[model samples]
Target chain A: MTGFTTTESLAAYMPEQNIDTDAIYPARYLLLMEREGLGPYLFHDRRFHGDGTPKEGFILDLEPFSKAQVLVAGAGFGCGSSREQAVWALTGFGVRCVIAPSFGEIFAGNALKNGLLTIALPEEVVARIGAAAQRGARFRIDLEECILCVDNEIVATIDLPEGQRMALLNGWDETDVLLQEEGDAISGFETRHRMAQPWLFQGST
Target chain B: MGRTLYDKLWDSHVIRSYDDGSALLYVDRHLLHEVSTPQSFIAIEKKGRSVRRPDANLAVPDHVVSTTNRHLPIADPLARAQTQRLVENVARHKIPFIPLDDQRQGIVHVIGPEQGFTLPGITLACGDSHTSTHGAFGCLAFGIGASECGIVMATQAIRQQRTKTMRVNLVGLQSPFINAKDIALAFIARIGANGAAGHAVEYAGPVVAKMSMAERMTLCNMSIEAGARVGLIAPDDQTFDYLRGRPMAPKGEMFEHALTYWRTLPSDADAQFHRELTLDVSDVEPHVTWGTSPEDAAPIGARVPSPEDLTEATRRERRRRALAYMDLKPGDPLEAIAIDVVFIGSCTNSRIEDLRAAAAVVAGRHVAAHVKAIVVPGSGLVREQAEREGLAQTFLDAGFEWREPGCSMCVGMNGDRLEPGQRCASTSNRNFEGRQGVGGRTHLMSPAMAAAAAVTGRLTDVRKLMGGKP
Candidate 1:
């Protein structure tokens, strides 16, 4: 399990809210039938024209800002369906962390599982960070301290439950978690079911 | 401190908690559909296991077949195979099967509740995501993977985890013309998607009690949007009354006993929950998804939001991305935005009530010449009932194509699809790109709203089509 750490550089940001899976990866790209090509189409509809030419005034396509990773957004973030493709698209597009007032319940799961650190700050703090990003403020998020610290100053504290923090920091997928407890679960099921269903296991291997 | 519907169901299902964090929970009812059962059926075949408690399992074929021509061969080979496999598996398992031509045939979620099977204080699992629709009846319903479905088939149960209870309380009577779908959209958009993941959400408050059973189903159908496994509304007198006389419902003295138990299913007011979210239904209006996600919605009369208004990380990025995909100029009125197609079907809003809502709009009017419009009912029974009531003819007379039951254009996969760059107003569960077919943009809305889109070639307030609000 890799530590869920981020290299937050001091950079100002582009802002928007209510982002959805389709915008992250358009349907045309999903036709590729593989998760690998998905990243290229991340914001493809928003950043480029039908002919693949760059669209001017697009927030993601803007210089310096285009390279920026951390984003500050409004409350109720990741507010969409259970499509984990959105997270894959975001991480594939190079976003390492998201700072929002609140993250969408499913998107948070997808993000945390994929090593995308979600920083939930208070609404006022989120607004301040947005303003700072609008003015091109750059900073790095420290997963260990759980803060979005900017050039020798702390911008915001991000709170994740200790368990989730550990899961992210250690890259624990559902398979990994299941495997960790498989032995105990199987043994307990057998021992408990024997008494309840003695006839069913009379000749079990 | 009131107990939420989810808490009650979860407590009732506990067989034993395991040390490894999962629990052995008893399943009261198990629902199966075609899309996710084939692999499970194959697995069971390999294991030489017969479906345990076949009487407790119910099977319906939805999600893949076309509603365009029920009698005709399923044009898509993949869908045809899936439908065929469903028949074979269910027959072998000896469960009650509802095929396409059967009067009971419909979307699994619709049939689950309408057939008087989805009861309160029960746990149900189906392969389809929209199975959450059963939550309207106080059932703890959720989607499961194919492997889990196989387990449920062979053993009549699966290990389950207790869920945190999240209470969603609505306040005030909804504004005029605002329906349950509007309130649901508003709730998801308010909390953002994923607000209720890992939690069982209970729909409460006076506004919920005011809703009809079908309306409650519509509100609960979008539970996935909130990241909740299911959305539940406790059974009240209204619920019992709706179920008491149904064809499959318990009758006479047995019905009375069922009612006594059903009434007790609601939590006694002092029940506690892990979390609570509240909303005032009066503030909700005709809503539209401005962006690609269901949560990116705004009131129909509102303007497309600019990125400056967004203060969160992924949200800002999402808005920027949605604007790009939609090719919308900021500040554009959502209602005025033109659409190319209008699809009125899906497990979400394709019930008989939805057909009635849409028929009210198209009865006296023709669809827009440029908008390719169609009305697909959710079930064969709904289709027959609509025909008997002249609803189908009314839609056809309004220049809207009428179709049979199947998940048409909702998730593509079947013959139905939209041309690239064409935008549609759909009553389906999602508005994701290509979700209806590649490059097609879906704007999720209610049936009446879809009818309005069909009539106007743009998103319009359904009140305009109603001639006045109902």
Candidate 2:
């Protein structure tokens, strides 16, 4: 996962709420078993017509927005399905940060795991960003400062849980986080737990 | 201070609390399916990590297994590879696995509770989102992503943040025509798709207490569709009775001991919730999604909502997009919409009870000539039970194809899919675009509703088909 501290980029505005995983990357494309090259499939059903032609009116197909690195979406973005492909698709499309009023819980976790920053701001502030993005404005998201800025003015100060913030800032793999714990303590707890609840380990052998 | 059932369950599973407000929580049981775990197993192998407690985990190949015929080998190259990978990974790691040929093989969520792996007062994790189905047994069960699956497999614990609790009181007696799926769809429609975004929902009140364990599972299964990670109902006699004498359940004296523990697993009288809402199910008619999102649902007889009905411009625009994608028009009656297929199976509503309900509707009635109706049982056990009760014969007699168990047509990865522009009345939880297949439009409904649609060749209200007023 790429570590993130800050990025300043133009925002691609998607005003629709409940932009589900199925829309982000449709199920048909999920059989490949690999997450690579999913960016083209992002919003495939919505962005393309049945004849395989691009829908020019779709937000991602418009000028300037096609190369956007920030996605300013409406409330409840990524609200359906548990597929991590959704985050992968966004990152594949070069969307480094997603700014929404709120996000689905699982989608947010998956975003953090994949190094995509998900920033939750007040609905009013997000609406303002949506308005600004419509006018081709650019914004910067600083993870260390927990703030979003446009033209040197703070747009919103976001709230991030300490664990997620540090994980993003350091690009810490979960396995590394667990490995940092004291080995003796983990083994000691395991030994005691196995002894106390032998039935719990009945079928392992 | 009174604690809700979710609080009690979470508190009991806490292995260690961290200064950063996250905790290492013990997972009592972990369920795995093919699509989600292949990447996790690959990651574990790359890291050279062995599963910490293989006994605590169970693996099955459901998502990619072909549901058409269990006797034949999987024909799709990708599906076969996924199933083979899962089998090899489970064998190498020494985890208990249910092969596709095994009688116990089924959807991970269905097999967990049916095989007695899901018990009261435990913390369950699965890579799939519908793991909330286990919460029906009074457990703290929720979904996890691929990364979390690898973490739990390697360490038997997951670091988590405590979630706020929301209590949804379903007050009043429900109509007999209203099955649990209707109730869940109604709830999701009432609270928009993201209503429970970050909370664990506890279904309480009179209507919930009266529901059977299977119905409770149906209700909890759709928590994901509403953006909730966990949904639970406290265990009672219904739960204990459902678990007694199962293959994996504890024997006589131990069962009694377990019962005593389960008896103590309800929310306290004065438990506080961060948010509380009451839904009266007494008048909730059968619901069907008219658009891509689950929240875009209306009663069976209601007209499709136009974007003009929405006050917010964003919402209105979304409605217009959804309407265009679904190929629906404003004021179109839901019942008047025709369907090309009717799928009666998924983790959501494919249990024995669900089969019986659909069977009753289509017992002597033949499916309309133009509709392709298929009934895929949730698991082999469910299929066996349905066959023993002659439900399979009833469905077959009614021209509905009776198939083997797997997640057929639910996610459409295993070669069961609809042709482009085909509409389906599905019992699966999701109604997202292409959920059943590419360019396939889905209308989520109950099993009976789906069966009724099959017989009528359109979206007909089950109540109306039963000679009752719509």
Candidate 3:
């Protein structure tokens, strides 16, 4: 529900391709139910050992990276599971933006709803951002201007679909947006649909 | 030009199209499971909105339900609480629910089509990624997140972006002991994991045409593994026959009329596609994943790939990590890799046909001494049917546990998990790191291949066990 316009923060990079949702937030913690307080469980399997101790030299556990709000990750980031908790975990862990070459389609959609901006840049552009983040650069994500900056230098010009850009800028609840803008269209479609395809509604009522 | 099946389904369901290229798609069926619905229900309650079409939604507790001790309360407190919340939420919303103890209670994907809620030419959405399984019936089905689930619950529609269409033509001879799971993995390995990203892949050609509905579901179910949100097959006699006489399907004249429309649901011969691929399955042997991603798969005869062989830096790093996690040495033969567990269930390959295939492999043989194999049916009905057909007995006699229905070891949420460092030959969709359990190594394979692994104490070519060509 928080509007996202721009953020200048420490950036982190994880160069492993296909970092799936299960790794982001493992399935074992899924039963915790409530969406909040999932920060500790973010990358639970990767962050901790079997005895629940943090692994030494882990990138996120390191200084500066622990406070990172921007992540420049490898290709196919968040590429498994439809668990919205992955987004919840990322935002909870203070990651406001993720720049990757590609993302799991479902995870990308989920990220939009949660205000965690996902920017799918070209592979080379993502690599450049990852390199910058590895050098401890502070990145600025300007959603309104559609550009990403590192150390005050524009690294890549970002482009987002207009509707997504509007939603993120204003923090619009999609359900409310639909009802307010296209309520009549929904009702009319339902009425016309039932009459045209009566068999689809044969026994449900 | 002619239209694609996706275009037809999308056009029929669109309430309105936005200039940004996304459309408000009317959801005809919405499947819900315990794990994904809690937040959606909370969001809807906070918004002071009620379900607009409760009749269109079906709820079940699958992810957290214990496969063992079905009549008893859930053992894990957190899991129990989550399942209980679904019962309360669905009761309040008046959504039709299949209780955990119901014979029909199973993975949402399995039960939807089984109950006829997944009819062709409809737009179906679920909170789980495997919702693409319903697309096998020529439906516009794909997964949505919790917020979209909330929107669908309240408004019965979702704002969805248009997807490029792809036709994956399945060519080549149908190999023995090769199921749709193998074909899925084979093509995914060839195309990499994100092969069909942003595209709705439609499986076609003679090989696909000869597949059964269950096999078609297996292929579509793994569409997500290939980065495809939706996978489809043209509705044919096989699809209609599978749906006929089902509880919720149309009846009498209604069925006839539905068929008339469904007949026109396939992509026209001259339909345009954004991409096209031809998979020759004649060379697609039984595939087992050697690494974390589904794309890191190879045939049973192949050896583990060395990271040094990869030219790309990121791919090399991924393989190095996968090999370390799997405890597999580079150049190790895949068939010789030992497994400690054999899981023969999941929404991917837990249908009656899948059960029968595994049962046939383990009928007269016994499970290896070191392997702990289990057969968890997809649904309670599937379990009962397997029992009537004596497949359950065969598995039991083979030293395998015949358990109740639900996603057991696949997601590992129901107290069915592998210990750290355990290796499993599983018939599940994913081989992601720690997917079955923390530090667990999973080799994704077909049910028959898993059965072969169970009997041999290692990954074995399933054809050798079946007395066929190896």
Predicted model with the maximum TM-score: 3
Every candidate's DockQ is 0.13, 0.60, 0.79
Q: For residues A27-89, what per-residue lDDT tens digits would candidate 3 score against the true structure?
A: 998888788989999988788998999888777889979999998898788887999999999
Candidate 2 wrong stretches, greater than 4 Å:
A49-53, A182-199
Which candidate do you rate higher for lDDT, 2 or 3? 3
Report the C-alpha lDDT of model 1 over A81-100, residue by residue, as the tens digit.
44455666777777777787
Output the better candidate (1/2) by DockQ. 2
lDDT of 3: 0.92
Cα RMSD of all models vs. native, in order, equals: 6.7, 1.7, 0.9
lDDT of each: 0.72, 0.87, 0.92
Single out the weakest 10-residue window by summed lDDT for candidate 3 chain B. B63-72
State each candidate's chain A TM-score. Answer: 0.82, 0.92, 0.97
Query: Candidate 2 on B1-470: residue-level lDDT in tens?
Result: 89999988887767777787777787878998888887788778898988888888888988878887677889998888878888898999998899999988888889999888888888899988889999999999988888788888887778888989999999888886799888899899989899898899999989988998879999999998888999999998888888888777666877786677778789999889999999999889998899988888889989999899889999999899889878999999999999999999999999999999999999889999999999999999999999999999999999999888999899998998988899999999998878898788999999999999999999989999999877
| Cand. 2 TM to true fold | 0.97
Order of the predicted models by lDDT, top scorer first: 3, 2, 1
**Residue B425 displacement in candidate 3 (angstroms):** 0.5
User: Which order, best to worst by DockQ?
Assistant: 3, 2, 1
List the lowest-lDDT window of 10 residues for candidate 3 chain A.
A196-205
